[model samples]
Target: MTQQVPDKLVIAISSRALFDLDESHHIYETDGLAAYCAHQRAHESVPLAPGVAFPLVQKLLALNTPDPQRPRVEVILVSRNSADTGLRIFNSIRHSGLDIVRAAFTGGASSQRYLAAFGAHLFLSADAGDVRAAIDAGYAAATILPSSGQGEGAGGQLRIAFDGDAVLFSDVSERIYKQRGLAAFAANELAEAGTPLPGGPFKEFLAALHRIQADFPQDAAPLRTALITARSAPSHERAIRTLRAWNINIDEALFLGGMPKGPFLKAFGADIFFDDQQGHCDSARVHVATGHVPYGVANEAPASLPFSVVSQ
Candidate 1:
């Protein structure tokens, strides 16, 4: 009989997202693949410092301790480096004691293609192109951003934050806001307040986390979730009602009403924050670990604004 893959919350992450590989990445971009390969080989014995997602991965792996046979989470390393060049990443993984045994080394090929093969619920990478491709392919993916400080893993709690429209729920409301402005958007939401919003990219991922959270006592569960959005009072009702209809419980919800999300996320001590808008992601990355979910109306090249500015 063959061994079965455990029913776990599967996450596929890039080497850069798992560890700080900016220096190595710079070499590859500037000096080409040969130099990057050589550099990795030369530094093969050196342990890597943790990147933004390190603490999140650490806490996620900790969920496995209660039951070795049926771990709650599974993390897979998916990278563009060839197997030879990947030895350093594996070495660092060993040094850091991360239980990431499964991996796919695509050489210089895009690693996003293998996400579904790994049965990943979420994929995080430093490469924006790969993240965009993954999202286009219908996978829950985000491009990891730089962090202002090290992640908070000392608390032993996994705190995940999500954006509302275009993230947790479909971009329908967002399309109205983008096309007709706030007042019309508000009116639309008000009229549809009772209707449940359709699920978006991160919906399945959140459901998986909820399942893991259910395994532990609510008062003492190691996982905590928050809905941090730009939506305010009148519009917020729809989001709340939608979550209620879906039977999902978010530990916290912040309707900032266009206020910057960075400060709030920092105060929440979020291990990881995901947002569809690059503006929010940029701001939050400076305070906490952030991921850019390039999706919906916000990510589209605006007719009035330049592409770069809209994305920034």
Candidate 2:
């Protein structure tokens, strides 16, 4: 008998992560599964389209090593489909020239239940429930950004750039800025530079990525992180000192004085750029992958508000 091999990484990706769907169609638009089935029946020649995270998973598959001695990353797809559909999709991917380490389908209505029970190093989904469940399970789960769907390789070190004020730090300072204006917030930052603020929700995710990167020595890590913020001159100093005190080493930092960030992030060849403001993230998408952080503020009426910077 051949020896069994253990996986190096366990990645659970949702169906939406693997297929593409029409953006105009709402989940309810298709009478749920029955409608989807009918549509599939009509388009007999075409399989359900690939999803947003398809490209990212494809890139990940390229990173796998064939050597049995080396750690191997395993990707298991969990979806709300029949086992047969799952296997068929897996086979389709295999035939499409993707060297999959492994694949599976959960065949459950809720992707979260399957993810929690199966457990993986990471879980990816466009569905918030799956994302949240993976995060709750202490996994680095994230929603697939549209740009990440189209992204090719690291393009070099998989540059991940973040804004400082509302992306990495708490939104308290941002609230102060919005309520009292820029000067007041600047003064507070100057004063509180020595004091650590509450960490942002993405803080844990960043730290986890950092730890994974730590597997490589300081001299050679495949991932690089940067901080690009609107904070200017003297104010920028406070952020530097604060991050240093907090022991987070940002690979590159820019203090643009209320200038557009697209140029700089693009110049850096970032794989993903995240900001709380949709405007900034929108602009960053022109050059790289970008994402929006939903605000945790209570009682706030949600709207199609253009992105205003927030404290992450």
Candidate 3:
């Protein structure tokens, strides 16, 4: 008799994201999605980039033992294709015996657009904004890296860094910092020092991670997280107090005020860094993995850098 688990895990995936193989591996004569699905059904393992979807999924499933009380792991597949395609993929999911709860066809122009709105406990896709939205919505998300099909860099832990203002903490402080500049932002944070700042996009995921850590206290995996922001000294003080108040454990935090983050991120070995400023992402990407977050005060928007902001 399997021990029943009371709660269920909801994972929202794109029909294509679940495919077994890297569709772009061989020359494709058919449409990308169709060829991709065909390859998966043929048992051709797709080459997922390091620190990407398949690795994360594999890790999660490994954690899922038979919990008689907990509902079976459920995967919700979303796609922008016709119902026929969705059904075909759904059938494939069923045949594979993967824990699939449902399938939805969003029929949007881009699959990324649809996946962002398909809320689940986790979202896997390459869209930066969609990934940001999913994180904002309290879902764990990972982007499919284009290169290095498998395995993380040797010895180094997979490092993920988040910007404080909009990506990790509420944009309220960020907007103040942007509109009236740093001095005003510091004053406001000092005022709200005792009060908890509203959680930002990554709050839910951070909480989930804490829960996971609590469950598996002995096994501290190589996953590390950090907060890199441009708020130094007095300003950084309140943010620190806020996180402490929330009981979120961030492995590393840098209070860089008006300093380029690329070098610091390089030092931290950040696999990926998320920030609302295009310039920050631009500079950071040269030395480390970087993503541009598109939210918060419109005026504080960092100028577009030479790097690609959107994930392919």
Residue 179 in candidate 2 has what lDDT?
55
Cα lDDT computed for each candidate against the true fold: 0.89, 0.60, 0.58
Q: Which regions of candidate 1 fall more than 4 Å away from where they truly are?
A: 1-6, 151-154, 303-312
Q: Least lDDT summed over 10 consecutive residues: which range in candidate 3?
A: 303-312
Among these predicted structures, which one has the highest TM-score? 1
Model 1: lDDT to the true structure:
0.89
Backbone clashes under 3 angstroms, per model = 0, 10, 15
Query: Could you tell me the lDDT of residue 124 within candidate 3?
Result: 58
Pairs that collide in candidate 1 are none
- The sequence of per-residue lDDT tens digits that candidate 3 reaches over residues 130-201 is 555655555555443342223332254446678887767778877665556666777887777777778766
**Model 3, CA-based lDDT:** 0.58
